[model samples]
Target: MFIAFAGLPSSGKSSTARALGRIMEAETLLEPEESDWPLLVQERAVMGAFTALTWFRTVRVPKLFRAEDKRTQGGSVIVDSYYDVLIGDYLGKPAFNWLMPTNDPYFDAASAMVREDWNRLPKADVLVFLYLDEDTWMDFMKKRDRDFDRSAQLESHFEMQELMLQASRRAATEHHTKLLVIEQRSGSPEDTALRVRDRLEEFA
Candidate 1:
């Protein structure tokens, strides 16, 4: 079994993924670190180059899936932020222009190339989306106290978060995978994980 957790920033994805991994005794793949990619790739702001890197990282997902499949032989694997992150953060961004662009040959070519491979990536058996109402999400963000959390424009952030949630839902439906939406405003991480585990039991 493979479970991928998707959500906006500060929406409890990392904590939920960790807790569920513990509950299932599954191997967990958290979000990839900056060190996981080449430094040049990390520095690139060129839309085409960034888009290509996103696809490159996405391609590695299935390999990890297969490796864990063999290791567990049928056990669960919990992914903190899988392809949905790419979709929400990169592909969904108009600024990134990953889908289509006018007059930029490289961007168009890269978009097509990545889209082809993106469609080939395997869907998770269960995609769990963690979200909160705007007020709750804002409160969580304020508590984190990150630099960006303090400095970035909240209006834009809220718009993007809502877009990402919608995109996640579409992706789950398009892939024909199981979708679980957990509201992260009312419980502790363990409580949410227990609820998720109970939901997973239904699929068993």
Candidate 2:
């Protein structure tokens, strides 16, 4: 089945999605980062964000390329993304843009374009939500210790996480995509993977 890893930043969706792909023998459609994006992730930002932007652009190539690539692959075909708002970045402060609903029309339009493109695809699949509570998320972010962030940015990141959850729910409910919200505690990756794998099988 087609699968998507959705969550706030640092929720471990990408890591889990990648592992799932490997275990299930499916092709992994990695998120935009480190590889290429139609635009850069503001070259000055932290490397992680820039990497993600780079990866996202590669996914946007013409459908023919996407379809062709998938043909050579198998398994669940998991796609990784923060599912964060497109407008949030342009209109938001670097540390807090995610909290905004992104009223910018063009950003909203770009989001529409992405959703439409994915929904129209023949292999569209479930939206897997990897959720973590705010405090834990703060701890996770702190561990990464990006210079752009500090204690002051914690509240905003938490707020952004809430908005992302809402957006993901909307995507699943309104767009006919499946939703799997995995609220996990800090722990081993295998433990988390097994928990999710069970969930996947339950739906199967």
Those runs of model 1 whose alpha carbons end farther than 4 Å from true positions after fitting are: 32-72, 84-106, 147-155
Where model 2 places Cα greater than 4 Å from the true spot, the runs are 32-75, 82-123, 147-155
TM-score of each: 0.72, 0.66
lDDT of 1 at 181: 84
Task: Encode model 1's per-residue lDDT on 1-204: one tens digit a residue.
Answer: 878887766787778888888888877777644356554444444435545455556655664466347445876688777543335335536533323344555655555654764466556778888877888887777765554334334424655556666766766777676888877875678888998999889998
lDDT (C-alpha) at residue 27 in model 1: 79
Error of 2 at 77 (Å): 0.7
Candidate 1 deviation (Cα RMSD): 4.3
lDDT by residue for model 2 over 69-182, one digit each (tens)? 565574346666534322222224343443223453344555564555445444345767778887778777766564334523554756665656666676666566677888
Model 2 lDDT at residue 97: 43
